[model samples]
Target chain A: MMTTVKQAEKFAAKTLTEDGLIDFFSGIGLIAIGYFWLIDNSALSAIMPLAIVNFWKISRKRISEPRIGKVTLARGKKGNVRAGRTILIIVSLTLAVGVILWLKGGAGDVQGTWYYPLFAAGPSLFIATITFFSAIYLKCPRFFGYAGWIIAAAGITIWLGEGPARALMISGVPFLVVGLWTFAKFLSAHPKADQ
Target chain B: MALKPEALDKVIHEPARLLIMTHLYVVTDADFVYLKRATGMTAGNLSTHLTKLEGAGFVKITKSFQGKKPKTTCKLTAKGRKAFEEYRKNILEVLKT
Candidate 1:
């Protein structure tokens, strides 16, 4: 009986990890970073969240439905609100810190010093932190691995002076590839239900 | 603190139905296919269990069509959730003793 309960719990946790939605969103966010850097266009990058949402919805309709079927999570409404607040807090903190540092020494004074590295590292660290929290909340260990990669990539980009935008793009590649792989695997695992 | 077996909910006592209820407790609603995959049960078995749950007013099943395809979703009713909670409490109490 205990074993059965454990298995049920395991299954519940696995549901969070099974869909690959996180990977897909992460991939899109990273690619947006890359595009932002390559084109130096903030406008293009600004659309990333929307793009991720649309892509996820479309993919769920096309790819996920045929395979794993639809699952409307019970806590989805509350989860969305929490996720939004978290992102807002992270973005606000990043901006506030950047503004403070810039005011202290001006852009020129801060550009070649520790401030530059901190600025470059801030967003990635935020992503890593969020992923870590998600890993804990979802009971999915794989997210920790993703967080590690984001942290490592952030550190490397700081050392290389690649800027946060470029670093995000660079770090995002693995997530994008992994997301695609996971999507493909999911497609194969469950075929479309017969009409 | 001996467990009165009668305290346990007979409807939720079955392992398969217990698993199904547990899944519903966590999520707002889940489709038939999702439940089947999660519980590793055949369509017929799952359907049968769902019928029992629905009959007991423990779960609400909704049927609709998405495009040309049919969709069936299940959710735990308020009574069902309360009962599950009570069931868990009783089980825990029994285990503690």
Candidate 2:
């Protein structure tokens, strides 16, 4: 029936809806950025995976999987190709820029002048790009909003010297709040599987 | 474009099964619960349709246990995908004629 297409589209949209996982991960990452200001930057990197794994375990056990059941979408070939292209572009650009800077002997000066801002912007840009691509690939428009938030946060950090901590929190808090809210709604929307 | 009644797939022509197939077409695999929620179909109704689809080789049903809970996941077979495409073409041809 013609209605089948509508129903299928609705199902696709539901699958893409935010359930708070993004918020949880990005929230912890932001909090880690705050810690980065006080401790070694490497510490934050180490904490990220552990934090994410723990959050995933908790969410699966307590929230999402128990309610809606675990749905693992197959990453189609197109998705893989897009991801591969994005990675290749980023790696190529980084290498080309590094080589140019090295040849010009401008690397040291640029790092000295713009280290903090560049450092902050790098991750922010990476997150924004991923979010943008995900929005397009998943047909989830909300990710575009998150991408905007990351860009804005990065812009603010660049404007304010010694603003990495604040920038991280600025971008991170919204994701955390939205994620938690979405999780709560998800819980209410889907009753316990046993029920 | 002349309409050919035989070109239509009777297996997929049924409404409930059509819905099930459409949902399966988008994702790689989905559990019974997820399909039930998406289709707004009763468990008995969905199970019956799934059995039919499975019998026709249009769907592959996998049964496994997660922490003692039985998990039933359904996937559209390559045959099913090709059949659905053909069905769509047949329907469009009918409409155009």
Best model per DockQ? 2
**Per-prediction DockQ:** 0.50, 0.51
Q: Which candidate is the best by lDDT?
A: 1
What is the overall TM-score of model 2 with all chains considered together? 0.83
Per-residue accuracy of model 1 over B1-97 as CA lDDT, tens digit each: 4777889999998988988988888777888877887777889999999999999999999999888888888899999999888998898887783
Task: Find the 10 residues in a row with the least total lDDT in model 2 chain B.
Answer: B88-97
Q: Give the clashing pairs for model 2.
A: none
Q: Alpha-carbon error at A111 in model 1, in Å?
A: 2.2
Report fnat for all candidates as fractions from 0 to 1: 0.52, 0.43
All candidates' lDDT scores? Answer: 0.77, 0.72
Q: What does the lDDT read for residue A136 in candidate 2?
A: 62
